[model samples]
Target chain A: MSEWALEVEQLAKKFPGVQALRGVDLTIPRGVTVGLLGPNGSGKSTLMRILAGVQRPSAGEVRVLGRRPGRETKERVAYVPEVEHLYPWMDVDEALRFTAAVFLDFNPDRAEEMLALAGLDREARIGDLSKGYRARLKLVLAMARDAELVLLDEPLSGIDLISREKVLDGFLRGHRPGETTVVITTHLVREVEPLLDRVAFLKEGRVVLDGEAEALRAKRGCSIEDLYREVFA
Target chain B: MTWDFDRNRPIYLQIGEEICRRIVRGDLPPGARTPSVRELAAELRVNPNTVQRAYQELERNGVLFARRGQGSFVREDPALVGRLRQQIAAAAARRYWTEVAALGMSPEEARRLIAGVIHDDKSSLR
Candidate 1:
């Protein structure tokens, strides 16, 4: 098996009017949580989309779990979009039951645990749920699946502080070291700084800096949030 | 289970220091089992790997030990915890001493300042 959960090299993506990525290279070892951080327009989501196989890179190579991203790799990878994608008509329990039925790797027990941890009501209708609860519910959906590589795109975006805490707290409880590799992309650096084992600073569709989170803090003599400010300053 | 961190320093180091502080404060008595990494990480909202690193460091420094298939525990020896307490105290004292020295305070003045603070009330120690 490849040591890296993800590897991207000379990767570039373009949409007729704009370039989303420009020759980016990144590699993350398995069993670590990575913060793919940058400003909103820095291509963080685009990169995530490509890795998730929802979109293809316009230029270079992409690998998930040492193989090209496809049906094979998709089995071991779980991708959560930045926005809420759950159906509003379905209640929390219905959504989870549907997911359990659709995805082979989904675990109902794990879903139950995440539901409690996220403080989500199983019978609450998706339309009646709070924004934060909806966000947490989406995460629970993704996390319930026992994927080797989990891709979370802006998990903290547009949520209140208390709800964000619940989302992060839920994620922390379910994440076991040496079992899954989590890649989280966010422009809000401070809130997720502590959960990062590694971080890559994306700017202008390229990685300007990347390193071990604690080592960067020690070397820069500042927090990752400050470092982000300086990089994009 | 609350956590406080300094943004300027490495969190794992701060975690290790915090654990030491807990031991000295008697909040985590010697021979007590430390919270499992997942539980602590969940409570702290930090990466499990970072928590693991802190536990490994504590084990390396003799403040903790782990049993296979079981969680880590604080060292059973009371003397070990006592020495650890002294080390922490010494570090804080050295920092205060250095700051006072920079301000041109003499040894006599420093001694008198400490004596007066304690003499004023026992609660001042807290």
Candidate 2:
């Protein structure tokens, strides 16, 4: 309970021309569901990508489970990018086989359970599923791992109401207490507020608000959705 | 079992009071197990943490007791129902007084208004 699951200190990232991150600091304890809140292009994805080791930070430090966010952390962390990057030609079973071959912690049983829960057929090709189902399938793949941390970027976006609720339920059902840390980045604050333990409000490459969900709600006397509008408006 | 609470008050506290009231009214009889946190949260469309807090408070207040690996059940204290009824009555009086004062009604006028409303409500129900 006392262990620090992930930590970032003065983290910064630079693209070809834009500075996406500017000295951001965040600390997440184990077993917490953190909501990474921000508008589009507010460095939420860049921060997540950097922590996933898909992109290196231009400066500063990041530690996942007390190790650098590289091979060591990569083995223990599961990341779901916002975009559908899975090969359209690959079937669901083939994708899981490839993913299981890559991540040591990948649980085939858990993956199959999540797939079944998400109602995605293993025989169907990725290109055949609807965009919403495709996103859900990718999410299920990421969540099936017994990783220390799971980074999800906009897992609720682009889905109908009924499907969105089902997907959210699958995410929670896949996680066990003290076994996984989930960082969900989304603009749909109201939909995801209940699952959040801590919330970080990012605005223009900076985290302007970061704290426990209840404390933030008490301070503003408003829901997280209203707080976002007040801060970003 | 059905309520739409105002967000102005803390949700957990309201849930705790509502549960106690249910117990006092025999809606949840003594020894009856309370709903699981997930069940109540899903039913209320509220955070599970909020429901957990309410259940914790209920246990602490001696209104409920948890059996390990089983579930929380309404406490069988002999005096609990009477005690809770008094507390609810006191709370209602406090709210009524405060509201009447805010509306600029004198004590006598407030009392008369309360009597009139209760009488009208009873007659209408009959």
Candidate 3:
């Protein structure tokens, strides 16, 4: 088994007109919570998609759990996209059932616990649920799986403070350090700063800064949010 | 207990100082089991790694001891506890003196003000 949960070497992605990732290289060790931080158009979501095996990188290599990203890697890696992907007609319970049916490692009891933690109603229809509740439901679905690597893309985006707290609490509840590695991407640095063990700052499809979160804070004498502003500004 | 972390310093150091304060204040009595890193992290809403760093620092300082398969506990030495209390007091005094000096107060005047505050019945320590 490899020491790293994720490894991306000279990874690049090209769209029809834009080069999303430009030879980006990153390595995340197992059992650490890493914040994948960057502004929009910085290729955070594209890197996540590539790691999740939903999209292929145009050049270079990507690995999850020491294996190249494939069906096997997908089994151990759970990816929560930035947009809502659940069927709108289905209720929360149906969504939970669908997730359980898809992921063999999905724990129904744990899912229920997470739903309660997030204050989500199991019987509420997905379409009728508010944005916050929908976000919570999505988190519940992603975290219910006992995957080795969990990638969360913009989990707190567009949610109110109270809802964000609920989702964060749920995420923490489901997290098992030294057993599972979590990679969360978000532009809201201050709120998630306390939760990150490491951070990788991206800019224009390239890694600008990456290091242990507390070490960076100690060296810079500032919060990660301030560091982000300085790096991007 | 609630932790208010300052953004100016690293959080693990703050966590370590907070735990030390609790120990010196007797809130976490000698021989009492310290909360596990995960429990404290969840309560503080901080990363578990940060909490682990704090625990490791405390252990290195002889404030806490860990047993195999069991959780950490406060050191049972009363002498060590007394020394820890004195250390905390000295740190607090140094910080107070520095701030008073920064305010341009002379040593004698700062002493008089501290004495007055200590003896004043109108003020609450809290």
Candidate 4:
């Protein structure tokens, strides 16, 4: 098996009017929490979708957990998209049950624990829950799965400050270090700065900077947020 | 315990320094079991690898010792803690001196000012 949990070589994706990704090459090792950061239209979402096995790459090769993004890889990879996917009619309990039914790796007991930690009501309807609660539920669903790789795209976006902390705490609580490889793509650099083991800065459909988080900070003599601003500015 | 991490420096170094301070302050007494890397990472909301780096650094410095599968612990040697405390104090003094020197103050003048401040502060006596 490859040492990397996710690997992309000369990956390219083209839309009708825009090139979403252009010859982007990246590798994320197993058991590391990597922050895939970039501005809008920087291909973060496109890369995430490809890794999740939802969208095929227009060109180049993509491997997740040493295999091509397909049924087997999808089963081992848990993806929480930027958009809400939960059925609005389903309550928190129903959503958990649905997720458990869909993925054999889903841990219902762990989901219950995460729900309590997030202060989410199992009986609350998905439609009635606040945007933050909905986000937390999504995180809980993704985290409860014992997937080898977890991908979260803009998980903190649109979340309130208080709920954001709760959700972040829930994430830390659910994740098992040295066991799962986590890739989080978000614009909130400052908030998630500390949690990143490695970081890859994407720009205009290409990777601009990729290195260990602490090494980058030490070399640049600045925080990740400052580095992001300098790179994207 | 809460740590204020500055963005300008490496986090692993900061984590190592924080644990050093805890050792000096007796917060982590000699022979005390240190929190696992996972636990510390969760508490600080940082990457476990970062914590592992810090712990490895500390271990290299002889400030911590790991007993395979049992977990890491503060060095049982009191002399090790004493030496670590002295090293930290010396580094702090050097930093203070550098800042004072940058202000064009002589060593004598800096000493006098420090003495005056300490004398005026009743809490320093404790």
Q: Give lDDT: candidate 3, residue B62.
A: 89
Candidate 4 residue lDDT tens string, A81-194: 999889999999999999899899998788988999999998999999999999999999999999999999999998899888887888888898888999999999998989
Model 1 regions lying over 4 Å from their true place: B98-111, B123-126
Error of 4 at B102 (Å): 2.6
True contacts kept of each: 0.90, 0.08, 0.65, 0.73
Identify the leading candidate in terms of TM-score.
Answer: 4
TM-scores, all candidates, are 0.94, 0.84, 0.94, 0.96
Single out the weakest 10-residue window by summed lDDT for candidate 4 chain A: A162-171
Candidate 3 per-residue lDDT over residues A117-232, each given as its tens digit: 88888899999999998999888998999999999999999989889988888888888877889999999998899999999998999888999999999999999999999999
In model 3, what lDDT does residue B69 have? Answer: 78
RMSD of each: 1.9, 3.3, 1.9, 1.6
Q: iRMS for all predictions?
A: 0.7, 3.2, 0.9, 1.2
Name the candidate that leads on DockQ.
1
Q: Residue A146 error for model 3, in Å? A: 1.1
In order, what DockQ does each candidate have?
0.85, 0.29, 0.74, 0.73
Name the runs in model 2 displaced over 4 angstroms.
A107-113, B1-11, B14-18, B21-27, B41-50, B81-126
Cα lDDT of model 4 by residue, B2-118, tens digit:
356887788899899889988999999999999998789878877778889999999998999888998899988969778978989999889989999999999999999888887
Per-candidate clash tally? 0, 0, 0, 0
